[model samples]
Target: METKNMEVIYQKVANILVEMIPEEWEKILLYAEVREGFSQIYFYYYPINQKQPVYSLDIVDVFNIDKTLHRKLKQELYECFEKLWNEFKVQSQEQLASLTYILDNMGRMKLNYGYEDISEISSEEKQDKWEAEYLV
Candidate 1:
């Protein structure tokens, strides 16, 4: 997957988040994955502060994004995957794209935490570790 597309998606999401998140939310981690034609396109957000354990919530509710905006974001996700398929298919001898293109990028302003592949670490474990290291 192209890093540019990921950056764009992150930026769009962050722009909306900036207006909605409370001042207490020191940082927010976004986990997005697209597997099997948007069937697994789950967007889970973990809002963190130094005083509390990291917790997950659906971003739409967390940010109070309405259905129209949610649908637009979902469409953007699908478009991104389509772009990936188009780019990858040409590079393959079989002329078929891989089904394992999942986007799980995490960024919060100047702080960026690298995520392990899905097979390596679960999102809950990452939240636990973050809480242990950063929270009171």
Candidate 2:
């Protein structure tokens, strides 16, 4: 696919995120970009009044996907989004905790991406390492 089309795809991905989780749409999406020849899909989220994204993930090895898998990817992602949204919805906190989902499969990525308390963003590692790698 063309590079500009990749941007459009990322935009569509971002839009799907907003559509999936309307309540926290703004916080749910910061940007999407196809990098390294589409081998990676970067998903970013910036919280309100925050300069940086609280969480992120990079879906690894996305390039060279078969057309059938590519189509299925979107549907599978929507299903994941819905389930994660439900998880977010049921939390008892008055304010939603800083939430992040890695939702990764099919390739290796460094970020855990598994569901966890967003507040527990580690102090062990520098924030910059965490800043990269958004879940897509």
Candidate 3:
């Protein structure tokens, strides 16, 4: 697809995502079936490391679009797939990991951990704290 069309379609994709996605979601991954006529589009979300996507949305019948629009959307979808997917993967992983850790240790929490940079808190300091607190 050409640049102008691609930009418009990118806008369309963003609109669909914004409309469909919840504010709390970390990221969304979209997959489209490219075809000359009507095509199906699928959306995936990874809330965890799992065998399949945690959430899926089927955009095949969105607005009862005609074949021409569907074809155009498919082309744009195909072109934009890689960039969108890569971004979602990179951004979601860290957020999901942090959430998982907090939830898994909610009842048994002792030490506090920050998801972002913690270079100031040295490993030796942590080991000393643990040994002092628990070893006695």
Candidate 4:
């Protein structure tokens, strides 16, 4: 895809996030991983007084976003992530088949993408690594 087009897609994603996130929350973090035959994405929110995130998919209900808008956001996010995965594969010369990313907040827009072997790692270890990398 062209750089301009990607930029537009990114903006669309940011816009959706802005609309969906609650005003009272400090920030929300989205983590996604795509590999071979598996892919998943989840969101976690940090409220003003919370030390740890209150993880939930209840954002849809909380935001009171209509089903159509929710579907649109999901589609845009999936497409953007698919493009990122493909680009990573090309840039890395196909050495990596898996890609994961942590996208935090809209204004700060901290995006960190990398590849890791989850099959060999413990879930606890994965959680620890993510917290260390992004929560701090």
- Top-lDDT candidate index: 4
Q: Any idea what lDDT model 1 has?
A: 0.43
TM-score of every candidate:
0.40, 0.27, 0.35, 0.63
Please report the TM-score between candidate 1 and the true structure: 0.40
| Candidate 2 local lDDT, 1-136, one digit each (tens) | 1234433433454445444331232344332111112212224544446565433333223224344554465565544334433343455323222233332222112212223333334443423454554432
List the lowest-lDDT window of 10 residues for candidate 2: 31-40
Reference-based lDDT, each prediction: 0.43, 0.36, 0.39, 0.60
RMSD of each: 7.5, 16.8, 17.5, 4.1
Stronger candidate by lDDT (2 vs 3): 3
Which TM-score value belongs to model 3? Answer: 0.35
Which candidate has the top score in TM-score?
4
Q: What is the lDDT of residue 43 in candidate 2?
A: 48
Tens-place lDDT per residue, model 1, 29-119, is 4333333353223322334435442333344454555667656656665565455444444445232221322122244343233333343
- The order of the candidates by lDDT, greatest first, is 4, 1, 3, 2
